[model samples]
Target: MPAADALPIPVGAIVALFLAAFPIFWCAILWLIAGMGWRRLANAYPANSDPPDSADRIRFATLALGASVRSANYSGSINAWLAPSGLWLRPILPFRPFHAMVFIPWAHVRSVASERRMLMKLVRVALGGDVPDLVLSGRLAQAVLDRTKAKKR
Candidate 1:
């Protein structure tokens, strides 16, 4: 094939290109929506929330976020609250807040349990929502559940 040999691509090729690209395009949109939606929820919460009372401070990472809470690339460990009422999963960047923050109520939690995850214990909390579950560290999850007096299953 010479430098200027190829003419305009065939219509079939164009259609195929679009078909292949659409999935990625749609995925990006959905991801943006999920992140923004959670960000809005986070901002809606009182930023001046009373300082964690008997709160178990933990290094929390938003492993995922969205209506589905799919797996993701979470970075920057931040201080989070596993309150007597809910779980605040988000980074505490002084100025740059994560788009997918979380605050989950205990009443909406269907179960609280733990299992081995690699070298650490992973506490799985089943919730009642579009994203019905979260995996946090055992130490933090246990402390929060104990304080909230939420039943475990």
Candidate 2:
């Protein structure tokens, strides 16, 4: 008969390993965010406060920001709010490290165009100035466009 020996991991070692990995993980996330142009978006449309209570919220939305080549895809991780003033977007907690909530005013949204991609429909929103375009599903895009139109009236 043979018995197997069990090895216990030291609590301090586990803690130390986590401490060392945390910063690196955070840095990598920051790099990814920056690469996806979230930093640029933040610079242009930083949301200092939360979305208004009256704003209509869409959870688990899909959105793409920046150029298609280097876009940041927040598939099912986006919380989008449609207000009379603008469109508010923020990522879920885990993906929110360097991504500040952004509010792109209707005035800043230059254009909204709908296109069919294969079987799915998509909307491309062009913003003013140096801000990159925002691509979202057709439904969300329609909501945003509706808000903008309402604001104009």
Query: What is the lDDT of every predicted structure here?
Result: 0.55, 0.80
Clashes of each: 0, 0
Kindly list the per-residue Cα lDDT of model 1 for residues 33-108, writing each as its tens digit.
4464445445444244543678666764433232243443243354567666666666555313344455666676
Which pairs clash (backbone N, Cα, C closer than 3 Å) in model 1? none
Where does candidate 2 have its weakest 10-residue lDDT segment?
1-10
Model 1 local distance difference test score: 0.55
Q: Which parts of model 2 have CA positions greater than 4 angstroms off?
A: 1-23, 149-153
Off by over 4 Å in 1: 1-54, 60-70, 73-76, 94-101, 145-153
In candidate 1 the C-alpha lDDT for residue 45 amounts to 44
Task: Give each model a TM-score.
Answer: 0.50, 0.79
Which one is best on TM-score?
A: 2
